[model samples]
Target: PNLLPEQVTGTRIVSQGRRESDYNLIGLTDPRGNKYYWIGPQHEGELLRHDDTDYHAIGDGAVSVTPLHVDLTHEGALKSLREAFG
Candidate 1:
């Protein structure tokens, strides 16, 4: 989805990291007809941060393929807590 400056007039997602406010391109495609959501901050600096696990491999000139998981919670911790409580 293309976000225009006029479209995000009152939203907090406006580009504040750049010198001039401009919309950055972000896209997602579902080739297999599965539902997915892609949410993250856009790169706005001259040098990319190495701490981002999502796109760090891409920054190093390597092909990155990240597998998506339905649940994002820490399952190990959850299982331990469940066993302790019950």
Candidate 2:
């Protein structure tokens, strides 16, 4: 087809290492002035600092994709909380 399907968001099912590579491949800036990349899948809870750069597989019959934003604002909430508490 010459035109792309409306249901397709251009996203594909990627695997380990590949996902990480894609995540860190390049920085993509969105319309909201936020830059981000694919960072594997984050099903629940926040990602641990040590595990942030790791990739995981979803074998639970569910497809979860994590889009990690490349912006200082990512830690804005934590930074502000620390300042407020201190």
Candidate 3:
């Protein structure tokens, strides 16, 4: 099937795994004196951060394809770790 640019648009793939923490913890105590901590994902730069997926998916009207598996390993440290601990 033939497709046109106007009909189907390809968008930039937004990379995930932002090292910068984007969550917050709310500490509270119940009536029974039991302390509890609630962790939730904050709406941090949802549509403003360039590397964020929502930025392109929601802001831009295009197909946003996110990889199922992304390698977040620090390749630069591999050589040093190998030499030191090999």
The C-alpha RMSD in Å for every predicted model, in order, reads: 16.2, 13.9, 7.5
Q: Report the CA-based lDDT of candidate 3 relative to the real structure.
A: 0.63
Per-residue CA lDDT of model 2 for 1-86, tens digit only, reads 12346633343244332332222245678999998975644434343323222232233222335555456565878889999998
Cα lDDT of model 2 overall?
Answer: 0.44
The better-scoring model by TM-score among 2 and 3 is: 3
Error of 1 at 11 (Å): 37
Each model's C-alpha lDDT?
A: 0.47, 0.44, 0.63
Model 3, range 1-86, lDDT digits (tens) per residue? 03456754556676643435468898999999999998976655443456557445534555666677769888889988999999
> Model 1: runs farther than 4 Å from truth?
1-52, 72-86
Please give, for residues 24-59, the per-residue lDDT of candidate 1 as tens digits.
555566998776665544544354334434344434
TM-score of 2: 0.18
Task: Judging by TM-score against the true structure, name the best candidate.
Answer: 3
Backbone clashes counted, model 2:
0
